[model samples]
Target: MSDKLTKQSIEETFRELSNWGRWGEEDEVGTLNNVRPEDIVAAAGLIRRGKVFGLGVPLDQPLQSVPHKRWNTIHTFMQDGADVATGMFEGRLQYADDAINLPTHSSTHWDALAHVFNDGRMYNGHDARRFGSKGFPVNGIEKMANRMVGRGVLLDVARFKGVDSLEDEYAITNAELDACAAAQGVEIRAGDFVLIRTGYQERFWSRGDWAGHTTGMAPGLHFESCYWLKEKDVAAVAADNYAVEARPAEGEGFSYPWHGVVIPAMGLTMGEMFYLRELAADCAQDGVYEFFFCAPPLNLPGGSGSPINPQAIK
Candidate 1:
């Protein structure tokens, strides 16, 4: 590996790992196509204990730590008790109504294929210029609503390494992922949603360090793991971190180099900021790292991403 990755290396990796024509020319769902109906049925069979885990943090918490100065969820009431008391409604059947304003990525969410790009193209060679204030015209978050249900494989890397959380900027390599799965006695299979628990979120919860969890240095997948993910044919990859790839990025001339290859080039969807503490505890107790994973984003047309409360049933 070169200390400073050149532009040509990035371009070559994009060309080599691309899933451009794998599904179809106009495909929007990307690697989610790997999840067949039978895979969903098999995932359902893993729910023996009937214990469910909600994988999203409360959206109302202020996320001032996030990048680009993104604001957290704002819940405002259109009609409330005060309004009712004021006799705002003419009809006797008065009801409370409310609405929420939030950036989709402000909480636990899935990044649509159009959320990132390489050069001037998105997934399946869609022009990046197609996105604007109207949002993505192609490969929008709506296209992934039905494609999110399937088997989920949990690789608790932090627990495997005997740490509460991985050190900052620690990149989990392909070999580490393999070793973690082997230690947990779990198999990484095609069409599975692989969740890597780095315990970064747990650290944030325990310390009340939102800035450290969000904008500060972090641990995540290595750039080389993109090839490993492609080889496994997983439907998606998620983690308990801001970006799924390590921060202070490995490449000298690049930022978020893993995102360049995975999202746009390989057409792989990604989930971020998942709350996996309890789920990891349960998996550790039962020694069962596989579960029925289901998370469907809101069907918003032209959305770049959508907040999700992913569920893991065991």
Candidate 2:
């Protein structure tokens, strides 16, 4: 087997990028340890004009175009005016109640450290078998809820390249990342929640092209860009694409190699399918890409991931 596919080489890659034992033997939050107390204070200080942007797509909309096993969000009304009219509630107070059942990753969401595995192992070298029908016993999404608030930096790569959307399967290299940051006049700092805008979400919004945006080729971070994130000590990295990395897997006989390294090896949480159109526009207009960001995942114990409505305040 080639070095890229060989077991020994993959192990070496894990060792090189792993954040295991960084905080402790029993650590679950992974790179979130980088977000110190001072980091939160600094992120809060970035709030100026009080402009807030919600970086999540509506979950009510059905995404039937993506050729995937995951189903769209299904919202059901448990109690409504009809029930009140039917005298279901004897009390004078009338209320509407509803429930939703959907995949945890059905929309904009954060993937926990246990969301991916490598060689039957999870983040911090936990056994992948620990996660089953009961959900992740360790490295659950609940462990990350408190550390989700931090400094946010937007790297608008599509705007930097003068394109509305990058071509399909376009891999954004570290060089481009650096160039985009430089052009935006923002420096990527440790413990910052870095949001990359590839303009992929805009395609669906403008052309109603869900098939092309979801199942077709998409642009995103290059496989090697995980090293760049490691070097910067970023707390979390998100993108306006289905997957955070470029589609049509760069590695042969492998799918989402970036997920393998970042989630299992590096223990880095990733946000996918985020809505960054409004935030990117504001960043470009004001020339201010730094903001106070917060996105607390649901305190779902044993969950491998959770949907989030991330907010960016500037």
Tell me the spans in candidate 2 whose CA falls farther than 4 Å from its real position: 1-11, 64-67
Score each candidate by Cα lDDT.
Answer: 0.89, 0.87
TM-score of 1: 0.95
Residue runs of model 1 more than 4 Å from their true location after superposition: 87-93, 250-253
Candidate 1 per-residue lDDT, tens place, 73-142, comes to: 8899988999889998898988999999898888899999988877778999888985689888799999
In candidate 2, the residue pairs with backbone N, CA or C atoms under 3 Å apart (3 or more residues apart, or in different chains) clash, namely: none
- lDDT (10s digit) by residue, model 2, range 147-213: 8998999999999999999987888999999999999999999999999999988888887656645
lDDT agreement of model 1 with the native: 0.89
Query: In model 2, what is the error at residue 220, expressed in angstroms?
Result: 0.3
Error of 2 at 1 (Å): 21
